[model samples]
Target: MTMTSAMPDGRAERASTKSFYLIAWRWHFYAGLYVAPFLLVLALTGLMMLWTSVLSGRDGEKYYTVTPAQTQVAVSAQADAALAAIPNGKVVQYIAPRTEEGAAIFRVNNGDASSMVAVDPYNGTVLGSWDRRNGLYDLANKIHGTLMIGDLGDRLIEVAAGFGIVLIVTGLYLWWPREGKGFGSVLVPQFAARGRQLWKSLHVTVGFYISLILMIFLVSGLSWAGIWGDKFTQAWSTFPAAKWDNVPLSDATHASMNHGGVKEVPWTLEQTSMPMSGSDAGKMGIAEGQPVNLDGIVAFARSIGFNNRFQLGFPADDSGVWTLSRDTMSNDSANPLSDRTVHIDQYTGKVLADVGFSDYGVPGKAMAVGIAFHEGDMGVWNIVLVTVFCLSIIFMSVSGMVMWWKRRPAGASRLMAPAVPGDMKLWKTGAIIMLAVSLLFPLTGAVLLTVIALDYLIVRRVKPLKRALS
Candidate 1:
């Protein structure tokens, strides 16, 4: 039960331990002070993101075909019913419908152009037109996203994420044991061990193992809120322009395409080919503005190879075109248009741009794959990886906060580590390690350093705190 000194030279050990804390604890104190609020917000928001995902989970609505009355009613008729349901002055942003099921959704402007409402296509029933931010779930989302304070909240989150990355990295460095120790000691918690070392062991050992996953979450999340993420997304998405074979659209159907803006026609009909964005004629030429036979168009798509297709995203502008992207579920590719995209004319129904998975560019393919990885779309195998990453984020958020909280002092704490007698080598050594570890968390260190510089002028040089910590 007696402690034995392993150090052969006591003096040497004493020397190393002496100023350790003065350097370390002080560093830990200020770093935490600077970014605690930010860290806290990130944790809170992250927790919400986690819990909310489950609450919001719903199977994509299962579709059932309406009776003959419903099927006989065209989109135009449903559009009329919806018109009467909505308060006048509002405009439709988009009308989405399933021909087979006869269910339609109109994303509408709720008088005020800035906000929108979701309307039922079947009966023109108004689900609700509410501000997304003001709703309970949305409020949580905004708070999690921007802290509800707007730009300041956004910047704080970014800064916090930046610091979080730093914390994970430095926590790893601080966690490194002095060489010779092997896996079991490092990995398994020594339950009987008391104080800081026990907790640090739990935090670092577990935290480091999960860091890569945490980093992915952090980076992916940042993409949702920043320009860098958009750039990353764009870089990864397929820009079909370059790889596509650009043919002239001169002979392409001179039929009125969309409501107003021009759109490219699907280049090829078969599974092997994709529509290339053609020349100015294909881009601009369109003659008749006659209303195309809606039923015929639908039948044509079915005949060409787009069976069991997901909802089509009809293009809006001149550069826009109708595309039939497939549903990932059911592995349905029977329709030639089934596993791919078919961009056709609005009036003549001529193919403008037809692209399938085969022609997707590297970036496009990478994006598809990366997103699948990010979202756990691959398989049960990938779900394991995705689950690990999500759980890691939950842990990192928790541990980082706990470490910060555990280190903080009892009251209206200042941004400085409390000092103990440097004369005791053990205390000094512990303090220094704390300081170094805290410092390693770049944000904490920077904040502490700034506080140290300021503390001299205020607490010591100016007045009050001299009585407190001293």
Candidate 2:
């Protein structure tokens, strides 16, 4: 009698486990179907960006080779060379060469168009000039950010990233070792396995290995998304302008410092209001005889410890401050912890406000470090690790589709999604979990709810739709 009762209990437990597994598998399938393409694109573009940064540099071959001189020409002279390259051009920003051998990059505006002119610091010769946003690497970055479709594409990518979390979670649950399974089977792909089994092994193994990396990439990337990053997180993470004591705040925010809609300010100060120039409300940064120009600002920046690839933003108006910034966001500094931004009065050459990494709020600090790692700016190891992670993502995406294709019945026209388990208890629990996920990722949640409503209200009620989905 005891044995018989134990048998039924064991059966019941196994049945429950099987039901939960099936539900998780179904959701995984659904998520992969939609998210795989986006993941592949992101991985490819990300790989391109990584290599471009490593080889030609993010600004392209401009940073590659320049003969260093014992003494270099003045930054103002370099600016003149850059401006002379374009008719009626106004210099907006000057990016000091990362090294003595690197070319100085000047952002020039001519009417409605913007261009970046590279000049040799040694001779103030125009090395090259191109549209600021048209570089191959920049194109890759744009595709990675917005898919070249603006807001709608950004939203779609955001949703995909959010759902990618779901994929990782469900994938882990599905790949969890069953009783008696060995480490080799779980960790390594079995070459002996054929067809779907081979694909499944490869997929599960690679997915498990790269899960954490994928999560990090997803979260970091999402931090730049429109709704979640900009509206919510960025708003709270921004440095408070109240920190500037006795300085007159400008009507413009630090976002005005950005060039061609590209973020140039430190992540923490992007939303913070900039201090205006006009009042004698800052410490004198320039010498008595020096004028407030590119050369003076560069000298002031170096004196204030803004060294190694710091960017200088020329004053936009008479009241605007000359902005000097060094942050990992622009790859200006390798160390994210050393991020600093200073605004100098263009008229008085007085330092208006100076903010550093230590001054950032908790969220700001996290993003500062996170963005550095995300961009593989930590070191060569970071580049290698991220490159492997990107390749793995591509492999996993392709393998998943292969597995699905292999499993499909011959001549079947419908998607062979896993059947919904008959147990309402598990289904209800899943619904609750999904609800929580939706709340956390609003755009993802909206998409999930729409799919659920369609599945129940439309697909279930319509025979053709039901058949097609099943």
Candidate 3:
């Protein structure tokens, strides 16, 4: 079986395949260079946050108590006690305890400062207070979300997350074994392999295993991003206010309920307009003999089945309604399916609107569950699974850098990127795919276009860069 007679197009097919692999390798390398550091940071911070949340809890023991009295003081008395603790402070919200032995948490504001005041439910005594955003768990969350650099950090992280997808895709293609290679080559690393081969084996094997989970994490995390998550996805998928019949809408939104620089409402409800309190348009009214106050609102909330660690956002202004929300997003309830939000007219004592998981659209429902899983709030199994996923991400990022370092020429001054293939036709298809991805992820698209332009205009034109890169 001579080669010329065996297959007329054998050489062309092999060349095409080789070119595809090289293109994939080049993009994979570029994406890894940018995404690896961000992934490492995300993995480390996420791991710390997960353990902190699981072990010590977000509020910590200072927010709870060990004993429960037979008789508890009124909610109003608790609010007064919390007010006395901080001079010139106003009560913003009241969080019900998870159990009888737990203390109620109150959000108190004093001028520019916000603090969480834990009050003993039994006798209305202020147990302790701490700045809401300065807690260790909150610090980890801020770093994880914004790198503590605010909006700029948010955009940069979003770009990294977007390109991370590109890395995963190209990595998989390059990792795919050629014909005659067994499953062990794909599934298991050869410990005997040395240098770059060892790194490649470990990198590909671990990357392949965590690819799906990593993708899920990226998508769910992206849904919280400013542009994609908030403007595009969340705006379209949020719970609509049209469901509320004849309720007067306020200029303020559910975002106003997010006091102390922390999000208290569910993602889908953040943009939903909060209904005003002036109108008596609600269907449900307060119980007989109950006054239109915190006690009545609490009773109303319990009557509607909002139990166990539900949060209550007090009226901020005349138009504001008392908001009672319970969701797995806040770790208030264990089950995502039980997520609910109720708004009550502060004066008229009417239930303005109530939204539950069933009321959510497909996207909203999915996000609810996804966020719970993302935060490792489901159970012990979820914590273990998320921990493994985080560790795998860390390992993959470190291994990728090792591979790149090993592949670079000795004493190289520039990035040793993969060479461009000779045939340009295959790259046209790749360019179109990259364009589509960029369009979907705005920041990623802009970065990719800039890199491509630099490669053509700057990198290839500069003598030192071209030589080093080659």
Count clashing residue pairs in model 2: 0
Cα lDDT tens digits, model 1, 271-380, are: 12333332332332223553434334444556666554243544444444445444222112222222355555554545665556566655444434443344444455
Candidate achieving higher lDDT, 1 or 3: 3
State each model's C-alpha RMSD to the native.
9.9, 2.5, 2.7
* Per-model TM values vs. the true structure: 0.56, 0.95, 0.94
Error of 1 at 402 (Å): 4.6
What residue runs in model 3 are displaced by over 4 Å at the alpha carbon?
1-7, 61-63
Q: What are the lDDT figures for the candidates, one per model?
A: 0.46, 0.85, 0.84
In order of TM-score, best first, we have 2, 3, 1
TM-score of structure candidate 2: 0.95
**Of models 1 and 2, which has the larger TM-score?**
2
Highest TM-score among the candidates is held by which one? 2
Candidate 1 wrong stretches, greater than 4 Å: 1-40, 46-84, 87-104, 110-137, 194-198, 230-470
Model 3 C-alpha lDDT per residue in residues 288-352, reported as the tens digit of each score: 55798988888778887988788888888888888889988788877999999988888878889
